[model samples]
Target: MSSDLWSFSLSTYAQPGVEPACLQLQSAGINVCLLLCGLWLGERGVAFNEHRLQQLRSVAEPWDAEVVRPLRALRVNWKVVAADDGELNALREQVKALELEAERHLLVRLERTALSWPQGEATDLSAWLNGVAAGAAHLDRDALHQLRVAVTGT
Candidate 1:
């Protein structure tokens, strides 16, 4: 695993909650391919990086695009909330759940993507391990274990 990537992901999780965590992960080089898919599904005006989308498309299968598009759109829309305090907390919880679901789906997609890797591209196992190491620093052992299982299908 790349220590640089591991440190990056770990730093992101050290933040408050899911959105900040997601933002941090993005900053730290988490796959924005799904985020790009979200953009294709009408998630414009959110300031996603175009180069990241191109990287995602490079590794993605044609069918995977269809699968990820709606999921990414759902993730984009799920982050919206009203102004009420009570409603805001509820929205936060819902967003957290959605983020977790998105991460799970990303894990599956990454696993599939790993299978078709080119000669020098890093393996999914290394990436998963890096994510796990990062997650372990912030999440509980149980949550870390769950993430491991999600990523590795074990």
Candidate 2:
């Protein structure tokens, strides 16, 4: 385990298949930062509950919508044009960095919010993943399972 949400996220995301799985989930409207936090909590054996899930969501939603999404939108929007225009490509790279930084900030906020929560009391990783992943109408179960397997080596 990485001992911190940001480090955990970085390492887990670097795992084989995790990036594509996360991208699939992200396209399904999941907040990747929040999902990573849930995975961190689950791996740490923190028990899952609706209240805690909501608390994390509350912390993530606004920052994601207001900060992360816009930067990502700009970066994604510039992708095609950026391939040709050196100036726009440079700007897009900056936007991509900003987007990553925004996600890192969100992870920090999530970790701070979860700092007081107890750990090592739960074993059902699916509970945490599913809870955070709830409400996505078209979620990819295979992609989610890929994340679980990649993280837990199960």
Candidate 3:
């Protein structure tokens, strides 16, 4: 019942690795909240308003070049497939979904770091940048697990 999707990303990925266990748990309706929360957070940022998306795209340009572009290419290719190809399209959607989720998480984290800066700290941006880096590093560990689980279906 926790609203904090960040924490549950790890568990969500874990579920896929143990599919039989998860199916059993699902049947019993136990702790499905983690899965639900991950799904919710995973989808939340995929459709940001145009203005916000623009801002995010701008900020993400440098880091996103390598990661986002390939995912987008995959999504586009997936979209062009004939309607009868459901499985491939579904896989593409999942890949795109996870990429969007990661992007959203990073965007929010970057924004939070930016907002935390005081006017005077503009003179020494390195400290703020370091803090953001550390925070991202911490989040990456859990996010990686969540993403892996999402793709592999543990």
Per-residue lDDT tens digits for candidate 1, residues 1-154, read: 2122223233333433534444444445344434323222211122223443344446554434555445555646545543445666576667667655655465445335433333333323333334323422243434433333433345
For model 2, the stretches where C-alpha displacement exceeds 4 angstroms are none
* Candidate 3 residue-wise lDDT at 83: 48
TM-score of each: 0.32, 0.98, 0.36
Better of 1 and 2 by TM-score: 2
Tens-digit lDDT track for model 2 on 57-141? 9999999999999999999999999999999999998999999999999999999999999999998789988998889869999
Order of models, best lDDT first: 2, 3, 1
Tens digits of lDDT, candidate 3, 1-154 = 2234444444443554445534344344322223332243333322222343334335555545666557766787778782469898789879889776755565444354233222331222222212222322223334334433453343
RMSD per candidate (Å) reads 13.3, 0.6, 15.4
Worst 10 residues of 3 by lDDT: 124-133
Model 1 stretches with alpha carbons more than 4 Å out = 2-83, 116-154
Better of 2 and 3 by lDDT: 2
lDDT for model 3, on a 0 to 1 scale? 0.43
lDDT of each: 0.40, 0.94, 0.43
